[model samples]
Target: MDARFLGIPELAEAPSVAVVIDVMRAYTVAAWAFAQGAEKIVLAESLDDALALKARHPDWVALKDGPPAPGFDAVNSPGLLRSVDLGGRTVVQKTTAGTVGALAVKEASLVLCAGFVVAEATARILRSRGCDSVTFVVTGEDGRADEDLACAQYIARRTTETTTDATGFLRRAGASRAATELTEGVRRGAHPDDVALCLELDRFRFAMVATLEDELMVLRPHDVPSPTGTAAA
Candidate 1:
């Protein structure tokens, strides 16, 4: 098997099995929502589309990354989602990088949204597929967001049965500019726990898989079995 690490710019030409990683917050929020028992999540291309979807389905929970919008339930903050009872409800998500990266990959046969919160499960799912090639789309722009790239490295190493330096990766991730900025946001009264929650590794045990349905990028959890071929406890 071959694994190649790329960024958002290379997403369109990604190989058959691809994992779109957004460790700063997006996919981490999705993981928490699923852990809270959300039925499914729709990855909206834009905030406008997310609002429209919320309008169409009043029962669906609309989530975004910006200031409050009309009819939106909440922002994409995993720390905030812990209090909500999301059981059996649909979630419509909009974010600048994560959702865009998930939708931009047109050639991948399989697409999965990932973060450090679900990194181990992401690797488990990829390994079980037995695919020839896998592409890790670190959804950060240019050389920014080193945390996402570190996550890709960890998942890649895990999926290929190679040794990974989790501690070193975590150190690199914590010192990144993205981490610093988000931490600054916390001091300004944003979701204070978001940065901490997002950095927690392997917090969830399921992989969030995305599939295009009626032009919507729908995300649902795919449970990854243990190396012993049974459900992870």
Candidate 2:
């Protein structure tokens, strides 16, 4: 298998399998939403698109980067989702890095979103599916944030059977500009637990896979069986 790492700028013409990583915190929020019983997540490329979808559904939650918009339930924060009820509900998400990177990979055969929460399951799925080539796209804050790159490198090392300094990677990510901004947000009493949640590794066992359904990109959990003869939930 051929696995390569690319930044957000290279997402337009990504490889057959594209793994999008955004650790501080888009995909991390996504995984939490899924764990909280969200039916599926629709990734919108723009705020307008998310609003339009919300207008039609009326009950679905529309999530954006900053403060929550009027009629929207919350912003892109995992900590906020803890108090929200998302049973069998859909979430429309639009973000600066993660969703944009996902939309740009139209040429990829398969697109999977990942953070530290689902990194191991993602790697296991890729290996089980026998993918010949894959590209890890780090959708950083300005197309180059350390947290996203570290998450991508972690997944790459796992899937490629390579050794990497795991502790050092996490330490560098915690010291990154993006991570520092999130920590600042926490200190200011905004989603006080988001920074810590985003940094946790292997918090969830299921990989989130993006698929096109009726022209919309929807993300759902993919269960991959582990070596212990049980599926990762």
Candidate 3:
């Protein structure tokens, strides 16, 4: 198995498996929704696409970044999911970086949207697949190591080295611009628990796999048995 770390811009060059990370919020929100029992999630290319999907299935829950749009149920905030029951409901989510990056790579056999919350599970899934090549897409990378990049680094390392502690990379993430803004966002009335929620390593036992079902980019949680018998950190 070989692993490559790539940014979202180079998604086309990705190989068999791609893990697109949006640790600051998007993927974290999805994990939380799944934890709350969401049936499936659709990663829309744009808010309009999400709205259209929602219109077709009016009962579907719609979540987007920032403030809620006209048809969206709420913003993609993990804290908010704690109170909602997403059981047996479809969720449509659109975001500036995460969803766009996740939908960009079309060639990979397995594509996963992830964050710190699903890092260990994502790695376990990769290990179980015996992937020949895998790329971790740093969705928010911009010549700086931010939360997404930090998560990719952590997942890639955990994929091959289960014994690797996440302390160092997490320390780096804590100081990154994205994490800094998250804390500030909380102070400025963003979800008070979002920052902590986003950084909770391996919070879920499953990984959210993005699959092209029919014409929709659907995301569903997958539980892959640990290949190395590794326990969650």
Off by over 4 Å in 3: 143-145, 186-189, 227-233
- Alpha-carbon shift of residue 1 in model 2 (angstroms): 3.6
Q: Put down candidate 1 lDDT per residue, 14-123, tens digits, no spaces.
A: 57888898987889999989889899999998888888998899999998886666678988777788789999999999887898888877457899899988888888
List model 3 lDDT by residue over 56-156, tens digit each: 99999998888655898978778877789988999998987888888887557889889999998998888877877887778885414477777888888
Listed in order, each prediction's TM-score against the native is: 0.93, 0.93, 0.92
What tens digits encode model 2's per-residue C-alpha lDDT throughout 3-80? 777777765565789998888778998999989889999999788899999999999988888776686667888788
Candidate with more favorable, higher lDDT: 2 or 3: 2
Candidate 1 yields a Cα-based lDDT of 0.82
TM-score of 2: 0.93
* Model 3: how far residue 85 lies from native, Å: 1.0
Q: What is the C-alpha lDDT of each candidate?
A: 0.82, 0.83, 0.82
Which wins on TM-score, candidate 2 or candidate 3? 2
Runs of candidate 2 with Cα error greater than 4 angstroms are 162-165, 186-190
Tell me the deviation in Å of residue 3 in model 2: 2.5
